[model samples]
Target chain A: MEIDLQGIVVIVGNYGSGKTEVSINLAVNKKRAGVDVKIADLDLVNPYFRTREARSQLSEIGIGVALPPEEYLQADLPILSPVVAGLIKNPVELTIIDAGGDDAGATVLATLADAFNGKSVHMLQVVNPLRPFTGTVKGCLKMRNEIETASKMTINGIIGNSNLIDETRPEDIYSGYEFVKLLSQESGLALKFITVPSNLMTEIDVSRFSCPVLQIKRQLVPPWKKAVKLS
Target chain B: MGKVLMKGNEAIGEAAIRAGCLNYFAYPITPQSEVAEYLSRRMPEVNGNFLQGESEVAVSYMIFGASAAGERVFTTSSSPGISLMSEAISYIAAAQCPAVFVNIMRGGPGLGGILPSQADYLQATKGIGHGDCRLLVMAPAGVQEAVEMVMMAFPLAEKYRNPVIILGDGLIGQMMEPVEFPDHLKSEPSNKDDWAINGMDTRKSTERNLVKSLFLDPTQLNDNNLILKAKYERMKKEEIRYEKYNTDSDYKVLIVSYGTMSRVCKTAIDQLKEEGIEVGLIRPQTLFPFPEAAVRETALKEGCKAVISIEMSMGQMVEDVSMSLQGKLPVSWYGKCGGDIPTPEEVIDAVKGLNV
Candidate 1:
């Protein structure tokens, strides 16, 4: 099944909930599918393991990456590049904004309220049950409210991104899907999609889930791994 | 609980709790503030105490106070925060209090960038504080090892009745990995009655317990230093831990690296072997004990021509590498400290350039 992700997608989630990974993979997936894709890295809360780490990789594949200026690339300041607002305003086939973790990180989006005004925005909350605050349905709902309030945007969808990194089992994916399904029912938000690592794609029976499955290539790895160098 | 993917900083906070350390005092710093964040929510669940001190200086003394009261206590901080805590760390050592300090090191010397760096090698191992003070330092390569080391640190600190340091780089604190905490490592605080100022009634001893770092008498101070010196000496004998990789092969270069840098070197070694070049590695799990005999023996291997200390620092660990070799072989340094970790290919190129 194809992912119907288009028109100003803002990915927000709790800390360590795989928001950056989901944002990167979603951009790549849409780009390869012949859509004009651009992504912005607004992760000022974290100084490491950010979407900009994969900037060159995205650019090599003909996807535009909008982040801070070169001088402030490594700085943990909440400085938004003009290109981000420009990208959102002009409206590409698919524009993904990888917001930072939690309400604190999402606060940056409120500053861009003028750019996001009157836009058809799909603010999706990437939920990883394995993380701390987003573990339970109540916790996930609480995070949704906090992120929505902080970003000045409502979370219209949920993205199930549950895995234990390299140790992810097929059962984990199935259970994670069920957890998000319950979350969708409780919160009245559509389950936009669920993510399965590219390595575990074949191992998992994708037919079991009715939602679109976004196969995640494990970016944002530790530096020891063969990683994409920061540009 | 089953294994879960967790950032190293969060896992460390949980590991301390699992290890029965219920008291946590810390000040927030990048790449490691997640530890304090995790504990702030978690400590309340377990009815444990978690306090964010006004500053790292105050936090270290809070650790000292809790540890002196016979409570298992620990703190996490970045490079500059650790510098502020150094004064109290020395006092804790002098007073013989068991406390754990986790330094998720960022680039350093001053307020360096928040990216990963191992430049705190000299600071952690040699000059943590004033006087002839030394801390037992353990370096973990990844999240799993980080969890295991944090769990082991409490017991080890109490065993020596001194402070222990878990030296990790920013990558270790920032990255997520699947970790399963060992159930057996959970332990209760032991031997606190002998020295801790818990309570006179609790100990039921006629004499009250006293905790003080100041022995104003010159002879008394000398005796205290001697006692500390003897403890460090005993640590060298009983606590030296290291791992040797590809040593049995006729490797030409011996790389002494630790923490995350060692993992990069390991990958380089594998790639070099594929290209018909043999390179061995000595990774020090414990930085303090230095693993001198291990390095000396590994470097003495017949075909090993030279040694290199590959680290994120300019050349801090190279001194220990040279001292370990005792001038038996040439030693060099190869690394980057400006927050960029050397890639495995770069490490392979460095190894190939040795021209052994």
Candidate 2:
């Protein structure tokens, strides 16, 4: 199944909304599908479970990755590499900027507004109904406005990714789809897709989804859980 | 009983709410911002008041006001932010108000990096504010312990009518762990008939209550200080908390540590045990009440030759260890600061360097 994600997909969400995990799996999925993919770790607020943590695997798979300088890579300062500007200007078939969570994190994306002007930039607000601010339609819409105001970019789509880490189930995806559907109709943002664990796909009815399903391979686990490579 | 994975900051917030503390005032600072964010949505649902004050300084006063009015209240901040609230902490201590302050400490001298550090040890236990005041400080080693400590902080604060601090490092704030808030720790709210400024109308009494730290007369101020000192002595006598591991058996050295650093020491001790070096640990769950007697007795244990204090700060807790031992035993120190957490192997090397 070809998920039609293309051209500078910027994923923004509240913290713990699973935006980073979604960004990693989306990059891997499109890369495996033979598209030239590049993921830029622009998250400067959160210090853990970022796209850069999967740099070794992403680079090993020939997916282009842009990160901070070698010395400042692990640091949480808001230092954006110059190459990120070049990537946004030149454009790849699929470029995923896994932005930091919350409006505080999305403020960094405003620096690239000029480079993304008139370009095919799909600023998608990833929503998890399980999280605090995005659990209701009103909260999600308030966050949508905040992200757009902070980034100086409009959100064109919503990606429902309601989950409870390892405790997530098939019903969560279905329930989240309904929640985000009403959110989409209320906010006028397209319902891009809802994510389902690849292992739970056999148990989920694909025909129930109106939009394409992004098969998520869990890559971000707590330190106690055994780490698994998505690819 | 049942366990749920939670971030330390969120867990502390939930623990406070579960402990009947409905008023929360805080300003966001990493890595403890999640606590404020969690309570913003949660407080209203539980009929609690959650406010993001203009600054840590303002929030500290907000806590003082709410707590003075006989409501259970708390606030959380990081290192520099805690430093900003130190003045208010001192005043709250002086006025004998019941409030809890949580410091999910990060690296600091100034606006230090946002990583785990125990650098606030001296600031917390020794010199939190101007004049003379000491907080009942507790350091939790894990998420579950943090929850339990936060729950205990309220009752302990009301028990003595003083400010209590839950000192945690960034690791405890950022890491996710399975935690269960004990059912027994959910305590009834303490009554405040004598001192709380809950207004005469609310209490339906003719007598007005004053909750101020100021005293014009020098003799009155001295008497207040003596009263506060007596309470400290009582706390030291009744509330000293520490855990001993491997101290029952003969050991060459005793390791003194607290908070997340203690867990690292436990692992290092296990590794040392495998190498035939018997090492024990004295983890002080409470920092202010200092567990001095426990340290002295552990140091006096037969076959214990030396004591080493392990911390993330540069030799802060070691002074307390030396004070506890009272020069009876030789004391050494191992520490790292500025967001650098010492590894288990590094701890092992330090233990070996002690050489009994």
Candidate 3:
């Protein structure tokens, strides 16, 4: 379960598979681990619930967030910030690129292939078994092939981030772990880690998981809730 | 079959399929484009038809065609796209064909940002298209409600032979929530044999059924409008849906809101109760058959100081609130437009200002 928490890590997944949540928590975890972390918001597909929504919170913690220019920040057009290319070319202790959802969202990564050529990138496919299209092993494999073909980058590992938001139970995490374990066996990709909501961490037994357990403090919430303050 | 986590857009697409709506025609627009994206793959699996029309104008006509043929059909689009579809909406409404339209609203008078906004309140409730046209409009507060409303819309549209609208904002279409497709809501399209153009051979009738909105004679046009008026009146008698929160208490401020904005008001109401400031909320689930009587009665409750319309629009629903009150009580408005939803704290501030 010793994941190499270094180099450029690109996170990809199906739409609504909690990719942005995993990306944000991973960057925060790496930052607390005393590593210089800078994350890029490369999501151009979804108009809402992207990494840029957490820009102020992430910036408060000294984690650099690269996003599209001010005018194009809210636009859905596929405009990648030049700073993303710069982040990919230069190396920090940990650089995370949060790609958009599905093959359509991941297609933007193919445009940055030149920047990622020389670096050792760990492209992890985040699988939330509760989400549509990735609920089965066959569906997970199909998504893997599509994402790999679309991004022109091979996935090296899997990040299990299964939950039904507030309705998630302990069995969901255990069953999600088992589901992703089966996916790793079928796809021959390593299981890097599994995520549990920080509130539910006490209910879950981490020893059941063979990989490291990443506690996710839910950041991307509905507008009505108090703004997430990640200390 | 079982409960699963899904985005509102995907849940709406599945709900239509479960409701036996086999035909879906749409032009992609955010943040509701996922409905088209989801149905494109799902429709074929169920032996249904999914078509991406060239534009919203074309898609709206496609809905008209399928509905006239006595088939269950629907389309999903955002603000500007719905504006494009309004012409056909008028045609379908006048033709008395059953059709369902889901407008996952984005901010706009024209081409506004693709963030969540309830700015289309007036457009949907009062003036959707030209002429005397009214749609049975339902608004949902969350994803599960969106699914239920989408499922109910088809049957309601057929029941009255008029177009039905599901009015949601971008957040309702984009946010993720766990939803269950109730087995009871799975329904077959009601018998459309009476007036549908289902071909002479199919109906086993020698006469052809003509479906058209044109009434060249002035008297005939007036009769047509009368029939439409009767259906709208029946809807007002039966379909005025609203949820009252904290109204049991002697509240000072009565807040009228709908869609996602209402959820924020609910949170503000709960927080205000803890601080000893009483605020009540009326969340209208149906926008067209607005809960007028309920709002008026609640606004006249004991210790009620004033009524405020809280929305994501620039005071669109306030007019409806004013109309409902009929000048019996003072009505005011507070909101933000172009995608910055008022947070619970901001809503609390607004409510406290009313108290002061």
What local distance difference test score does each model get? 0.90, 0.86, 0.91
lDDT of 3 by residue, A155-200 (tens): 9999999899989999999999999999999889999999999889
Candidate closest to the true structure, highest DockQ: 3
Query: What would you estimate as the lDDT of candidate 1?
Result: 0.90
Clashing pairs in 3: none
Task: Give the TM-score of each candidate.
Answer: 0.96, 0.80, 0.98
How should the candidates be ordered by DockQ, best one leading? Answer: 3, 1, 2
Q: Between candidates 2 and 3, which one is better according to TM-score?
A: 3
lDDT of 1 by residue, B1-356 (tens): 77888899999999999899999999998879999878988999999999999999999999999999999999999999999999999999999999999999999779989899999999999999998779999999989999999999999999999999999999889888888888855556768886788778867567878899999999999999999999999999999999999888999999999998998898889888989999999999999979999999999999889999999989998999999999989999999998999999989888888888
RMSD after CA superposition, every candidate: 2.0, 4.8, 1.4
Could you tell me which residue pairs clash in candidate 1?
Answer: none
Where model 3 places Cα greater than 4 Å from the true spot, the runs are A1-3, B184-187, B204-207
| lDDT for predicted candidate 2 compared with the true structure | 0.86
Assign candidate 2 its CAPRI class: incorrect
Candidate 2 residue lDDT tens string, B1-356: 33555678889999998888899999998889889888986899988899999999999999999878888899999999999999999999999888999999888789888888999999999898887898999999988899999999999999999999999998888776666777644444546765788667767567888888898899999999999999999999998999998887689899999998888888888878888888999999999989998999998898899999999999999999999899999999999997767888899999899766
In model 1, the Cα lDDT at residue A19 comes to 93
Off by over 4 Å in 2: A1-7, A21-36, A47-64, A68-82, A107-111, A117-231, B1-5, B44-47, B50-54, B178-189, B204-207, B244-251, B267-278, B298-304
Interface RMSD to the true structure, each candidate: 1.3, 4.5, 0.9
